[model samples]
Target: MKIGVDYVKVRRSERLIDMTQYLLDHPHDLIPLTFFAARYGSAKSSISEDLAIVKKTFKERGTGLLETIPGAAGGVVFTPSITDEEAKEYIESLAERLSEEDRLLPGGYVYLSDMLGQPDLLRKVGRIIAAQYLDKKVDAVMTVATKGVPIAQAVSYYLNAPFVIVRRDSKITEGSTVSVNYVSGSSERIEKMELSKRSLKRGSRVLIVDDFMKGGGTVNGMKSLIEEFEAELVGITVFAESKFKGERAIDDYNSLLFVQDVDTSTKTITVVPGNCFDKE
Candidate 1:
């Protein structure tokens, strides 16, 4: 290949590193081969070869995936995913931490803010959740305000979709809002939730995420909001669920960990793997 006189020739190793970094930074986005070719002052064929190597490495390491498109308008996109073994190990570690007696809070609630606030853990969570919906063509992620926000944001980061937050109180900044009333699953008291009318469009496919669920009243309320917008609820996932609760308001959902038992008197808790690993 003739090196362009106007541009400095870049080494193959440097090119590979740059290309891989670019793809990882812009996951789920398509970039034309011509763009990379021009940026590196190399031929499109060379760029394609580099991408193939990156794809192989990604698959071999169980990091993520690279999808190539053919033809003149084609390029590549990265999709974040986690291997089953790694995901299982991570969940088992999380459950162990959750079982600690010190994490127990008043009213039988478990404090998980420390784990949720960790960026590394949240990124792993994003990868696992995103992997589940890789083929679902999800349009947006929705969650109730506060605890669910981080999980929704993490999942949306990997999914390359925008996230919508439903608030417990109406905000004037949201302009016109749609509100719904449902019984709080944990407290068994009637509660209200609201979402902005402009935040979501009709017929959008949404994935609901939350940090915890007891009775699933909050998720059920979000479901009603989805109905009000004429959008579809693709799926629901929670970081954890309390097993002590009665029948959930929503049956179709996934949890990463289940709080199987908790005893305030003895300050002990038991946790088990959720239904995500159940053999179908």
Candidate 2:
């Protein structure tokens, strides 16, 4: 916590020890550049050099728990042997920042739709959910068309499961297919989707996923469609759920984000975690 040049002045004498400790304390949260810049407020090139040095030190010390995943949403992940004391500290810090009623929208919505695009966050959540169903016979993932794709894709990636898209309408692209009817939040009457009969094999276990839930009509219809295929509904998962959404018919599920609200007039977005992905 003792930052600034004063910390650096004495660093000329015992730099390596202090630097190694800093990396261990903030393993995953800091980007390499951010980590080094905080220590010295130095240039990007210098920070990169320092990261290289720190990484080498970690390897030589036999502490290979810090891993760097390359690419856009990728960074570091700390697989550590830390005590529950440290884990509690990290969880509490996130909870303090993320838990706020102001994040709720007008009516009863929470706006965490963006986390769907953050691969790093979704990957963590997906792994947790997929682990719960690992021994089960999950054959494929199902979801209503549109926004639900990302969650389905994430779970599919982790489970090595294929995803089946239940479209809102029959498209020429689908050719001959089976269709279903269900009410939607967007409408009260009913909506439809066409899934190729070949898309799912009978008696297969289907894992359903969606982005947001209000009424659960779309997902329910998805579940019913699985029944029609004589397939087992292994489980269902969502990115976010509105508390207002009345009794969900299906229970085995997970959610990453919880919508507090979406104040379109003020253009405010409020969200938190109702699911395990961002919880205490």
Candidate 3:
């Protein structure tokens, strides 16, 4: 409300706070200088100066990258990012928490539902994952059925893209749908998943996300669906992955945490940072 009001100039500190908040709210969006100037009833030169300060702080604090594109058709775009060191440190701590014995489930799956349901944690995870594919020009985020929906939604928020859900069964509400049959990682049974025909268009660049992985069959199935729609696979990421004994169905993907071992008899779980930080 203080912005874009009756040309009443605001204080420098107040303007900076509002401006930073605006940019944070609209990550991955292009905002023109004129828009900021009009919003705060300030001069273009002053707004530019304010942006410089915000950019410096963002960089120094490892918050993200703010880019200024010059010319009439260009504007400022903010990409939410985390420093490698910070991301590694955070992920390591997360891995540590997951290593607790109580986290081990009956079938070697780690209990991650509590963490997945947390908004703050999910937002941090989103920032870490979104930072990785900022340059991929992702049009949408994809996830299968119920469990992966939250992770997909979180990542989509930072990417500023819509998310599509793939269902285990085709729903009548979906109208016409596309289905892919994949081997179930846990049960090793062939299972089918469906996506709405209108969820994605041909040539759409999609990023797939999931909460966890064991045999990677589900993700592989999602990849097949991407091919079916003539869409591109920008990337695939999972929150946690178990140490699979058999050959995995999907080889190329990223995970935040790797479950090195899950001993149900001993009630122990060992978690470590996945290959996400290995690229660094």
Candidate 4:
């Protein structure tokens, strides 16, 4: 391995420096301990110790912050203090990056399917949304078909709860499915799905989750599904929210990605914890 005086400066071990750097660059990004241990050719136990040291030293210095979330979706998140100037600079940088020509898909779309698969990114985004609903007693998560499923899954996993899939159409095993009509992003009529009188219990609190909200139609559909179960709408969480002109259907919600671009080839995406500052 390429070693430098800076690398050797870690007062703990060789891995601590690497670990700190990993967390620094990927603030609020949650990752499994095994993955980092494997990446650095260290043991999970060894890495855990190293992380503890790193977390302690960094937190003491106010240069690092670590959060340990328990459960299947739980992991460590390292976040550094971000200044308002830095936030604006990053957002502008993202806008410029997304304005490139090569990134655009057909039909004036910027496909972000690949980014959703990233574990670290998903975890951080999920934590920010889940933070809003902490101690709210949310039962099951609900989301529309296809792309939104992953976002919903991430939130549900972090919340340590099962996510109810709302399909576009009914399947054989669904058994008396609940259907709701809604308008698509392109102004086309569409219907979303939910299992008929399934897992959601009465008066159960629910947090609506989705990947993107163009017009909040799908969000509303999911809200209506929650109503079908006689559940209380705790809050809505989204990975991204378009600031298009219209009233939002849901009141309390969280979003990581806020801006929407009408013309972009690269479809540069900007993300932040929009809900992290809100009152729970």
Worst 10 residues of 1 by lDDT: 1-10
Worst 10-residue stretch by lDDT in candidate 3?
Answer: 1-10
Candidate 3 residues lying further than 4 Å off, grouped into runs, are 1-10
Query: Of models 3 and 4, which has the larger TM-score?
Result: 3
Question: For each candidate, how many residue pairs have backbone atoms clashing (under 3 Å)?
Answer: 0, 8, 1, 2
The digit string of per-residue lDDT tens for model 2 on 204-259 reads 99988888777677888898788888889887777666655456555555664555
**What's the true lDDT of residue 257 in model 4?**
56
Candidate 2 TM-score, C-alpha based: 0.57
lDDT of 4 by residue, 79-167 (tens): 55333344345434444544455656776555667767878656655655565565466677877778887888877765666777788
Please state the error at residue 130 of candidate 1 in Å: 1.0
For model 3, residues 122-157, the per-residue Cα lDDT tens digits are 899999999889778999999987889889999988
Residue lDDT tens for model 1, 1-280: 3565323345677889899888878888998999899988888888999999999999999879899988878899888788999989999998998999999998877889888899999999898888888788889999998999999999999998999999998888999999999999777899999999999999999999999988899999999999999999999999998884477799998898999998999999899878777733
> For candidate 2, what is the lDDT?
0.64
- Native-vs-model 1 lDDT? 0.90
Cα RMSD, each candidate = 2.6, 12.0, 3.5, 8.6
Candidate 2 wrong stretches, greater than 4 Å: 1-113, 185-187, 245-252, 260-272, 275-280
- Report the error of model 4 at residue 7, Å: 31
* Winner of 1 and 2 under TM-score: 1
Collision pairs in model 3: 4-39
What TM-score does candidate 1 get on C-alpha atoms? 0.94
Query: Candidate 3 local accuracy as lDDT?
Result: 0.90
TM-score of each: 0.94, 0.57, 0.94, 0.61
In the predicted model 2, the residue pairs found to clash are 103-270, 105-260, 105-261, 109-260, 109-261, 110-259, 110-260, 110-261
Candidate 3, residue 124: Cα displacement in angstroms equals 0.6
